[model samples]
Target: MRITPDTLEIGSTQKRNKNETLETFLKRITHVSLVGKAIVLMENLNFCKNLNVLYLYDNKITYITGLECCRNLTRLYLQNNAIEEITGLDVGLDRLNVLHLHNNRIRRITGLHLLPSLEHLKLDNQRLDPGEQLEFDGECLLALASSLRYLTLTNNHIKDISPLEKLKSLESLDLAVNSIQDVEPLESLLSACSYLSNVNVLGNPVANAGPPVKLRQRLILASPTLTCLNEKDIPQVERMFVENMRHAQRSRRSAKDHNHTRDQTTSLGVSGTAGVATPACQEEKPFPHLPPFASQYRDLMLSQLTKNTATERRLSDSNLHISPRKVASAAEALHRD
Candidate 1:
């Protein structure tokens, strides 16, 4: 079935009355079910301006087309099809909320930056050529940062999920039975996207072979907002303990970072005094401050360096020297020129 105007009524949920015109019939169509119809080309039916939900799964649809008129479409099911690419769902799909394109031949997931209201996206079991890993579009990820909530990329053999870190609104993520071996990117994603509630990564060659308790502990530490992991519900008491552990670890991490920065400063100061080297140089100026630092500390550092340079007649001062503050004061010469 090629979805021509005459054959379009075969799967329509709307009934054309005895005297109803084609325009009126098209307008009345809010749902269409053409599953298993072996639809090779998606054409015609462009006048379904009021179509809300469409079901075209389990068919031979090779490409996504002719949906530009379904501006009111919200739920679209194109799974279990032969869709080798993702398109035709971008233009004028402002109200689309759910899309199912799983079990297709799509290798690169793209052309979805236009759907700002998209919430649920399923691209599981993508049929790709051998030695092909699922890829994502950067622009699409950025557009879905705020609107996307539920995402499923299961069985796609995706390894690096670092690109999904910007999807901060994700609440439930399903990456089960994939090839993800590292949870570091997932941890980073959790750090940015704190709204994740249910996450599934089972059947992946992750650290699941370890002790169950250890794995549970690691997941709990990874995301405190999670209530379910690999389809297993986490108890409230366990969540509390994990939150406490995360807080403790966060405090320890903060202290460690502070000490590390201080140690680096000390080492760099000593090296500068010995006329060897300093912190990684992005510039060759008087400021010996490390190039990589939090922006909020820049003001404090600038004032300190200016005070040291003006008062003590030295361009820099650090922990490398003794009695750094006792050297001189800017106010010492206040009574003079």
Candidate 2:
């Protein structure tokens, strides 16, 4: 393959020395699409310290460890790679703001906690799932707590977002297709981040969401300065809900008092009218059966006698202790006598 000077690509500056640094060559190459595992070697790209940006997309690179040498790297695109974990990134890359780690197999969000200068981060379409959620504490949110303003967490397994409350400066939080069920976890966060104005929670089931208000609506209604991109999406305020809550509480209190009163009355045996009050023992004969023709007259006459017997029973204090058989036998003997 012989090429003339006229056919040669311009800006092909080569060193006169036989041992030219790979950093010098890498420096010359502004954007390189690293193809199938050819080992894009910049073993010691020490001279490329001034390199501001590097795009290593679609490479078979399994790890991100050796990049600690790239101290001055400001923008790095490592999207669509075979990387499983993001480890070796140095905090020295303070100027690094944008990182594209979309379309990777990265499981946990552990090492990236130190990227304080990062502003825009994309972890979309990754292998994150509900069970494989970022089992993180507030430290991860605190890491990007201040510096991050924009974030895309679409298609991840993030469930509880209680950790995001510390991202006080976040403006755009795209959590479209995550497994977040409760919005209260993000409530304190929404209240804290005054800069936050847009929240994408469309794809998530409305049932899993927390509160009567959606994320966007809650932020707008709560914050005087916050406004949703679409105001119509805000839910309507139902006065019935407030009334129902108040009524429920009142009913519960009334029911408790009623039960307490019933228990007290039952305990005191003051149950009126229905109570069986036993009277004193009396030597009264059972009344004789009257003729059938005079039955009506006998009934009228016996009504008064029955009332008197009931009154006597009520007056007696210990009648409940006397056996019914003894009372019946005594009444028969009295009648016979």
Best by TM-score: 1
lDDT of 1 by residue, 1-337 (tens): 6786656676788789999887778877888888888888878758678889889899998888888788899999999999888988767899999999999999987899999999999999999888788988888899999999999999888887888888899999998887777767767777788999998888887757566676667777878788898899999998888778878999999999999987776665544555645577422334343323322344455567666665342323443232213222222332233
Pairs with steric clashes in candidate 1: none
Q: What is the C-alpha RMSD of each candidate to the true structure, in Å?
A: 14.9, 12.0
Tens digits of per-residue lDDT for model 2, 69-133: 56767778777777777777754777788998888888766677777689988877776544676
User: How many backbone clashes can be found in candidate 2?
Assistant: 4
In order, the Cα lDDT scores of the candidates are 0.79, 0.60
Off by over 4 Å in 2: 1-47, 207-216, 229-337
Please name the candidate that would achieve the greatest lDDT relative to the true structure: 1
Give TM per candidate: 0.71, 0.56
Give the lowest summed-lDDT range of ten residues in model 2.
2-11
